[model samples]
Target: MTIHSVPGDFHIPFDDLKVVARGLVRPECVLALDDGSLVTAHGQGGYSIISSVGEVSHHLAHCDTARKYVPNGIALAPNGKMLFADLGNQYGGIFSLDRHGHLETVLDSVDGTSLPPSNFVMVDEHDVLWFTVSTRNVPRSKSWNHHVRDGFIGVIDGDGARIVADGLGYTNEIAFSPDRRWVYVNETYAQRISRYPLTGSAAKPRLGKRETLVQLSEADLPDGLAFDVAGGLWVTCIASNKVLLVRPDRTVQVIVEDSDPAHVGRIAAGIRESSLEHADMQTPGNSRLGNVSSIAFGGRDMRTAYLGCLLDDCVRSFRSPIPGVALPHRSRRIR
Candidate 1:
């Protein structure tokens, strides 16, 4: 199949890009900090310390001796603490960064059992931390079949957290409604967004109602997500190799696409470099849907779009018309 670059009013040209660092990067979530820095929560061969320029730094000094590393989400605190969604082990949990960039476990479990390889972590307005657990047991993957049958969306009250919604088909992402009245999470296996209405109740463990927002097929697996200032949703297409804009009306639009597969750069030496600088290749065709995994806002007004690619081991960015909403405020503490 051929691929073509998607055009839209909110799109920006990929002419001005700055390389910070590269090499074995699995950056899942990105934050365009106020101080002109980009923080990436990358889980790969190992967790990497990264900057906005796409530079990867050394591991945080203080971390437990964990065998594997995979972080699916992250957020920063006003006081400079950073929280990461740790998804490496079977029982995923949350890790934090001290002032010295040392890693520490903040909230790893509920009821004495660790979170099940939780995905995105969102700190809401009340300082409540919200995230998703793909399964209590890691899905066994034999060849292409995934056997993760159950999933849950959860929230942590000041000292405790509970699964608010369950029996979900692989809940992989979590975001609050713009009005703060509902929580939205993408069921990866189901290929749709499931939302739960929320009142101001404390530690609400329930699902009032549900909406299947934007049903995506295997053509697109709903992965990373962020909202625009206008409340529109931005989702990454894991298989389609596109950035999809989901409007309030649930209309899906392809905002960007890669036309030149030949020019597509991969990370080298822990930094983004052109591997085909010497190899002669034909001009890229239109654009083929690929594995575009995650996306976030950056650049001057949070209008820049960054994409996570699963096929290649690097992150890519482009321009967008809308600005990104700031990470919400959520209070979470481990008991």
Candidate 2:
């Protein structure tokens, strides 16, 4: 793995009219709705709906997805149903939603115990819900320290659910490989992306055993990865203040850098919400609003890259050379 300084002249891309939501307080999770509007979960505020151009017009049924912590991850159920993962502040849980944002508890406890921070979520064609529990047990604000242990990947089968993978450290994000045989997760504190083969094995997948698709060091924090239709990864790096295009050959190059982290701080200083290994890496440029927390491909063709910046309270869309994975219909509504 080689790192390039990318001459000082480099610049990360920004939008001409970044979407700021009047109704959203601090958006922690965002998903594209079926009508092309966006469904966002906040740190304290609650869930909201926004326009393609970034207008916050309506609240989704006054739904509250978070507890001590606001919701962290959200996805459309396979049936176009609304499903969001919550950090329950002390424990984690998964909730369901309606277009208007009505809420219903789906699977709150796992393996007879309550959850610790439901960090991420994804649903497949069969309605088998794939989600993450940030930790099996951990304290608030200390989640980063256990990234490699608290992590567990499970499927809520048609009849509710059961734990499938266990003992993941501060697991933060989950996405399926294009072939659907593997689940890729990010260890925010460990600074690596682990790929677990979903062959239905009984044993817990160990970090030592799973392939590390990407690794960041003390300086770089890797977060919010998305797959292009080409099956490659578009990964955000906090330390370098850039997004990377990673190929299967284990080589990476900057897709965009020039991100404004002046407000967030340089890699050495750290971003406010950044995890342990890359704590000082998320600083956003004064003009950037905040660090890019989430990215989605939504447009009629799924070619536009939508960036969700938690700090700024808005979403930005960009034209990418590579196409992105088409999210399932329940969560993706392209107006």
What TM-scores do the predictions have?
Answer: 0.75, 0.78
lDDT of each residue in 190-295, candidate 1, tens digit only: 5677777776564443457777777765335577787877778888755445577887767777676554433332211111121222122112223332255666
TM-score (C-alpha) between model 2 and the true structure = 0.78
TM-score of 1: 0.75
Question: lDDT scores for all predictions?
Answer: 0.59, 0.61
Model 2 lDDT tens row, 1-335: 33323322333454443454555655656676546677776665246678766667544435443345456677766555566787664666887766655667778887787776687777766656778776665554454542336667777764456776666655677776677567777776566777877664323222224777877654345667777766677676543445666665556666665444343344434323444342332345444536566677766776666666556666666666656776664354422
On the 0 to 100 scale, the lDDT of residue 327 in model 1 is: 59
Worst 10 residues of 1 by lDDT: 267-276
Residue 81 error for model 1, in Å? 2.5
Off by over 4 Å in 1: 1-21, 44-56, 61-66, 99-101, 140-149, 202-207, 258-290, 310-313, 329-335
RMSD of each: 8.7, 5.5
